[model samples]
Target chain A: MKKKLIVKKNFLMSLFAVILGLIAGAILMFVTGSNPIEGFYYLFRGGLMNIERIGNSLATATPLIFAGLSVAFAFKTGLFNIGGAGQMLIGGLCATAVGLTFDWPKPILLTVIIIAAMIGGALWGALPGLLKARFNVHEVVATIMMNWIAYWTVFYLVPLYLKGPFLETESQRIPMAASLKVSWLTSLFSGSYINLGIFLAIIFVAITAFILERTTLGYELKAVGYNRDAAEAAGIGVNRNIVLSMAVAGALAGLGGATFYVGFASNMQIGVLPSQGFDGIAVALLGANSPWGVFAAALFFGLLHTGKGFMNAMTAIPPEIADTIIATIIYFAATSVLIERNWDKLNKFRLALRLRKSKQESLEDDSGGEQ
Target chain B: MVDLIYQLFPYAIAFTVPLLITSLGGLYSERSGVINIGLEGLMLMGMFVGALIISRTESIYPGTAIWIGLLAAMLFGAVFALLHAFACVTLNANQVISGIAINMIAAAVTVYLARLISGSGNIQIIRGLSRQTIPILSDIPILGRLLFTQTYATTWFVLLILVVATFLLYKTRFGLRLRACGEHPHAADSAGVNVYRMRYMAVIISGACAGLGGATFIVTISGEFNGTAAGLGFLALAALIFGQWKPWGILGAAFFFGFASTVANVSQVVPMLAQIPGIYLKTFPYVVTLAALVLSSKYSLAPKAIGEPYDKGKR
Candidate 1:
């Protein structure tokens, strides 16, 4: 019971730290003659003013949700998936290929492209996962290297592979058949080109949460993350969990890639590949690696990004400041030790007070008995 | 045949020097078990600051002194990385996430700070190091022209650092302690070695080395900083891995990468290769780096506790 209270205190301290960092940043801005209140007002109004703006936000949020989920999922099985960017890239390119090359019924074509993207992403993700599981290789090194490989591989291969009308230095336009339509929910988004992908993203998060929280597989995975030797002793297949978690994580990021092709851009070039995968890491960290937390974090990042255009339209403040804010939050949030140490102090104070009260009660009882 | 080898030699040596120096810098941090993902950021900051100082001073000797100015940038990079270390080391945060955060923050901060200073993202018109030819070897015909004809002060400095770093990591008592802290911090702590201090030292060394590499780039090649350390951090990272996290091994690997890079750029300029129809040849260096990374995947090993933070009580 005391332990639970300590955990709560640590959390509160970390929260306060983030608040302090924000205040410091705001003070800096104020001293520089940039009104903090006005800057934030511009930020909010520009980000969530109306249905169109909100739709733009969902469009931004969809990929991040997948990316955050990817990182969070991998975190559960004791692996770090730095290759999310690469996996997403592979997924993007694969989806683009399927979108351009295949001819099918509209719904079927869209499904095929999404599946292809997932497979591509999964394959990319599996390589590093397998290497680590089998060879005891460091995933951080492998995944980071893989990111560059994906970057240059796409750089070299995309031009050769892409075909059709949209195929210049940029990618080909995705077929209408391969596009995910949001015709049903146009009222919420006001036809801003944001589709049902936001719902899909939410559903994906739910699925991941459910799998991690309820299933035997989830229990086994969590066990491994906590302690590999203990998990192995408990008869859990540690290697399998590591590989499976990475594969599923990659698929989530792949879906993020599909969302871009089918729901938003309909065309992607090399540089245009969104930093969603990288941003997802920040999102997952900010959310403390919980799936639901990741969903909320994704929304926050989405809001920040969508508001960029709005912020630029309204104020001289660079939209990149929002990213700086996010980085600061992560920095403050990551320093949980300081928080834990403070909480420990608070717990010790409470314990001492409790002990003194008990002693006084005993003394009172002794006096009454003597009388 | 003679002409081809002669043309290749200068380009290879020139390019190899930077990669060797930078990757060797990467070795210090990684060997001590802090994955210095901020190497690229430090290099970028170093390049920018070093360029500005050298340009304002207008003397290569003072330009050489601009490396001291890079200590501020290195400290900046270290503090930036302290964010990562705090996350990964203190909070047991995921290493890759912390790293990516550092990369993002570094990129944004460097650009933002650069804009504040120069009114532009790109800093130009910086004074650079003039390549000095060896006094006695200038007349030694082909070999002299290839090996000793012209290079930055950093080229020789890197060679010397490599020898010293190689010794420091392997021969020195400090090296043994640093390696012990990385591999088994609890043991190191029990032995009264300051584990945290060692890790911080490793990371700071990485920042400084990365700074030197960045400083060298501005002073030698670019004469201006356009964030020319563009993705070179990853290349240095690749070299580190390809070298299997060993100092001498990484130097050789970096040299290979350097050779490939120079060949790619120079090959494009060659009249014969220029006649080719595709851009594939231009992308050869990145392709090689990719291949090197993938092929070395099986062999590269990290310290036992490379990314894990030391928690004495938990132990």
Candidate 2:
């Protein structure tokens, strides 16, 4: 019962953060000489106006879901994996390489591509984990360094090995057989960019939920996160769990890369770290680090992302405003500690008011009886 | 080799100055018990404001506009950092998340405004600081040629700030107090130091210095604000760690990174370096930083109470 209440409170906090974010966005719109209500109306309308748009929103959210899951998973171990971008890059590169090199049947090729991405991402994630566990190196710094290394690696490797026939900047387009899109799905969504990635995302979300809630590994990781010294004293191999958690986190992000590169995007672009990596942080924070919460948050963010361009087309507000709103939401989410404090204060104030009102009413009743 | 060294010297210094200053900014915040990963965002704010102000006023005030722009960037950057300060110091929020939020907001808002003003997400200034050789210093020997000749005024300015910062941080009572706040905030508070105020000031100073660093990049190297600092801010963070949070150490570390990056950028054209793959050169500094972290992990000189929120009631 208490756990359920805490979950509800977290949900409310997230909702409050979202509302604050929207208000901040409205203020920005107002400052920029646009009608806030009108801007938001069009933003939501643009996201939900058609089945095609909704599908696009889900497609856009596919990578975000995985990224969010990855971050959330690592956070459970008290590890900050800021190297999501690098991990994604590596994952995407591996998936792209497998897709381009092989001409196997679709199922076999896709499975190989996904596995390759997972392995690549896992290595990238595990390196920082190992460094942190063994050398006491801060994961944040290690991950960031890893990010730049991955960046330069992709910058060099893609152009040299995976370059398309004419373009020097991007990898060769994946063959149709390896793509996650299918004819039936496309037709169902009225030719939207939705693909197998969304279904993959949902499956992973459920799996992540199961692993985190029902598995011993999840308990160990959480135990370490709560108190490293205590967990160590309790015989948990804190170092091993840290490494394993990071590897798992990296695998999740790697799957995201596969879904992104092969499932959503057709080609791997060089010199660009996918922004979804950073957006994953926002999604995790707003989702309260819960798998289902992450799913819901990613979908909302996806809607904002998909709707932004349409809003820009229809209104004076720029597409960047959507990003602004999302960023503001993240900022509020980070500062939710203040809101939690204030919430308690408000509850106390209300109780005090009720108590004072009851005392006055009893005093009045006594005075009337004496009269 | 001599020719190549001479050619690369100025470019290397140009890159190092901004990084050095920014790392120093991070030094202040971290030394005051706050982890400020928002240096990147603060720097972006600096770049954007610098570009926006300079682009607007350069036509009318060609000689002085850049200075004004830089000043505005510092002001805006300091102002923007207040958000981070409020979140981390006042509200006791997660510093890392707050810093990330700062970065995201800076990136999005700057581009949003830039697109509004320029119709593209980039702002360019008409003129940037020119390299000027010091009159007396330039005639001195090889040292003069490499260090004093054809240098940016901002480079000298930043170097001066570095010296002052070193002195202020080491020689002053205020510095000691600030250091105390970071190392042991409860003790500092018991000793009559206002931990929160010191942290707020430190974070604000970090913002201002990081802002100056960003503007320095615009005036000296980039010559435009393109909505990103190209991870220079993160590199500055690495330098801060690499330097072990010391001012002079930061200078050396920043220069090392600067030199490495300059070599990577020019390696293709330099015959001596052409034999090596560019990837190695490009990733050298980051790899080196990771190695440094490993080597130094046994005896980390990090502030004792860094990243912890001060709660007077707890202790």
Candidate 3:
């Protein structure tokens, strides 16, 4: 019952944060001399107006789902994996290399590509974990350093190894044999960008949920997260768990990169770190670090991202308003403690009013009986 | 080698000043128990505001517009940091998350406003600071040629601020009280130091200094606002850590980074540096910082009570 209450409270808190974010967006619109209601109407309509648009939204959300899951998973282990951008870059690089190298059967080629991506990302992530575990180096700093290293590595490698025929900044396009997109799914979405990545995302979400709720490894990781000294006293191999957790987190993000580079986008672009990596942090926070919650939040953000372009085309509002709203939501989410305090106060006030009403009725009954 | 060093000296100093000031800003905040990762966003805000103000007033004010714009940026940055201070100090929110929020908000809002003012989402200034050599100081020796010649006015200003800040932090009662709050807030509170106030002041000062750093970048190197600081703020944060949170250490670290970056940027043209891969030079500072972190882990000088919300009722 207590667990159920906590879950319900989290849901309500998330809802409250979303509403506050929208209101902040509205205020910004108003301040900018645009009609907020009209802008919002067009925004939602653009996202859901047609089946193709819905498919596009889902496609946009595919990488976000994986990125969010990666962040949420690390968060469960009390680790902040801000190196998602670097991991994703490495993962994408690995996937691109695999896709461009071989001309094997479609199924076999894609399998190799995905595994390569995961391994690359895992190796990238484990170094920081190793540093943190052995040297007591802070993961935040290590991850950031890793990010720059990965950036420079990609910058140097892509031009030399993966460059396209003419363009110097991006990789050669992935052939259909290695891509995550299939004809049937494309036809089903009516020429939309949706691909097999969505199914993969769902499967991983379920897997993450199961592992976190029903597995011993998850329990041990959580215990260490809750209190390191206590977990050590309980004989948990804290160092091993930390490294394993980071490797797993890195794998998830690497999978996100695979979906992004081979599934959504046709080519890996150099000199750019994917913004989805940072957006994943917002998604995890707003989702309360839950797997399914991350899924839902990713979809919501995906819708906003997809619709913003249409909104910009139709109205005077710039596309950045969507970003502003998302940022505001994150800010509100960070300050949820203050919201919780107010919520409790409001509940207590309501309870006191109900008690006063009940007492008045009893007093009136007693007076009538005496008469 | 001497010729190359001479050629790069001014550029290195130009890059280092912004980082030095920004890292010192971080030092103040961390010393007061706040972990501010929002320096990047704060710098962006400063760059945008500085560009906007200078672009508007440069024609009218001629010589004084850049200074005015920098001052405005500092003011606005201080005002912006109040949100972080309120969230962390008053509401006791998670400092790291709140800092992230500050970053996101600043990035989005600044771009939104920039787009409104300029359709291209970039602000350009008509003029920027020029390098001026010191009159008497430039004729001394090799040291004078490298240090005193071709220096920006803002460089001298920032160096002066650094010295004053160092003195203020080490030699004053207020600084002692502020450092005490970061180390032991409860004890400081018992001794009549208002922890909340000190933290607020520290965070605000950080914002102002970061703003100045960003504006300095605009006037000295960039000469335009392009909605990003190219990760300089994060580099400064790394320098803060690599320096073990000391003023002199930060200066050295910042200079090391600046020199490395300048070399990387000019590697293709310089015959000696071209032999080495540009990628190595580009990644050197970050790699070295990580190594430093590993080496210094045993003697980490991070503030004792950093990133923790002070709760008087807990202990």
Candidate 4:
């Protein structure tokens, strides 16, 4: 019960922190000659005002959810997966290739594309994992280097293999069957391009939450995260856990890629990899590496992104300003020492309050006995 | 072949000078047990700051006073990169995440600040570092033209840094302490070396080096700051890894990468490679980097404790 209360307190503090950050961000905007009220009103309306807007938010959030899960899952297992961008690229291309070349029913086609994406991402991740497991090569270095390799390899191969009607540099579009259908509400905003990939994202989020909280594997992963040496002593295979963590992380990132291509982009067109993977790191961190936290964080980011675009369309502010706000918030968030310092003070205060109350109750009992 | 060499030569030198300068900066930081992933961000900030200062001052030499401004930026980067070091070194925060945070912060903040200063997202051309010709050496027919006819002050500065760093890392006691801290901080600490101080020193040196590299690229090569560092930080990083984290090795690798980069950019002008394949030729540098990375994986001789945080209490 005490542990639950502590967790609740931590959650409330994080909520307060986020609110403070947004307020700070708004003040900065106001000082910069932009009306914070209008800017944010536009941002919120753009994100949630209509069904089409909601669809757009969901579309943006879809890939982020996967990337967040990727980073979060890895964090839970005492590893850091920095190669999400490269893995996503490989997954995107693999899924696109399957989506374009294969001919099958809609369900089978989607399944194949997703599986292919996961496999491609898994292979990208596993190489670094295997290298680390075998050679003690730091996963950070290997994964970062592999990201570069995967990016370039994909960049080089895509133009050679998939150049289509979009002209010289771009890729061919995926087939109709491979594309995801938008919901009825989304269709009401007929011209809007949002799809139903958000449903898949939510489903995955639920599955991940369940696995982490309810499953033995989740317990083992948490154990490894808390203390790898202790987990190893308890008969957990640390190497296996690390590799599996990366593999799962890659698969999630891969699913993100699949959603991006099948639901959003015209093709698997990528001259340079999207910054989605890097953004996912921000998402995961802001969410505090929890499943629900990730969902909320993704939505917040999604709203900010959509609103930034709307602001650019409506006002004089450059869209990049939104990015600045986000970066600042995340930078502050990564200053975990600040959080720890505050928590220490809070704990001390609570301890003192408890001691004072206990003494007063004992004094009352003593007085009653005398009477 | 002569035409291809000629086309590649000028650009090859151009590419190598900036990368060499930057890779050396990375070496300084990594050798100190702090990985400077903010190299790219620092470079971006430097380019903008350097250009703005130069344009405003309107004199290349005095405007070059902006060079000192980079120390401010380096301090910022050191503080910023220290976030990574602290996460890794102190609280045992994942080095990669901390690095990514720096990268994200650097990108966003620099872009925002650039707008505030320039009144636009991009800065215009200013008095860039003009090429200087050596009187006697410039007169030589072929080799002189290739090596001495025209170059930025930074090229010479990079050469000097390489020599000095090599001496510092291998010859000097300070170098020995730095390496010892990186390889085994606890051991270094036991030897009465302040491991934290050494690591901080390494990262600061790296930030300054990276800052200089950023300034050089903006003031000399691009003639303006348009955020065109173009993932050069990563290339420099790749160079650092490919160089086996040694100063001399890094110089050699930077030169090779520079050659590949020049070839990729100018392949259209080189008649022989033009017919071979445009797409393949254009992507040669990244491909080379990828190949080098794969090849290095076969025998990576990285510093023993490259990414691991230093802990005083842990034996």
Instruction: Give candidate 3 regions above 4 Å deviation.
Output: A347-371
* Model 3 chain A lowest lDDT segment of ten: A270-279
| lDDT, candidate 2, B12-47, per-residue tens | 999999999999999999999999999999999999
lDDT of each: 0.73, 0.91, 0.89, 0.74
As for candidate 1, its interface RMSD to one decimal place is 3.7
Please give the lDDT score at residue B98 for candidate 3.
84
For candidate 4 chain B, the 10 contiguous residues with the lowest summed lDDT are: B69-78
**Evaluated on chain B only, what is the TM-score of candidate 3?**
0.98
- Candidate 1, residues A1-371, lDDT tens digits: the string is 97676446645654665575567546645755677788778777877999888888878888888998999899988888877888888888888888888899977887788789899989888877887787666677667766767776676567767744655567777766777655766656677768767878888888899999999999998999999999999999999988888888888888888887667777767643357877887777666677887887788778887886687567655566566666666556556556666677887899899999999999999999999
Among residues 3 or more apart in sequence or in different chains, the pairs in candidate 2 whose N, CA or C atoms overlap within 3 Å are none
> What is the TM-score of each predicted model, taking all chains together?
0.87, 0.96, 0.96, 0.88
lDDT of 4 by residue, A48-98 (tens): 887777777777888888888888888898777888888888888888888
List each candidate's DockQ score.
Answer: 0.35, 0.80, 0.73, 0.36
Q: Tell me the tens digit of each residue's lDDT in model 3 across B17-59.
A: 9999988988898899998888887888888888999999999
DockQ winner between candidates 1 and 4: 4
CAPRI rating of model 4: acceptable
lDDT for each residue of candidate 2 in A1-371, tens digit (9 for 90 to 100):
97996788789899999999999999998998889999998898888899999998999899999999999999999999888888999999999999899899988998888899999999999999999999999898898899889989998898889899999889999998888888899899998889998998999999999988998988999999999999999999999999999998998898898888988889998877788888899899889999999999999999999999899899878888989999999899999998889887887899999999999999999999999
DockQ: which candidate is best? 2
Give lDDT: candidate 3, residue A295: 96
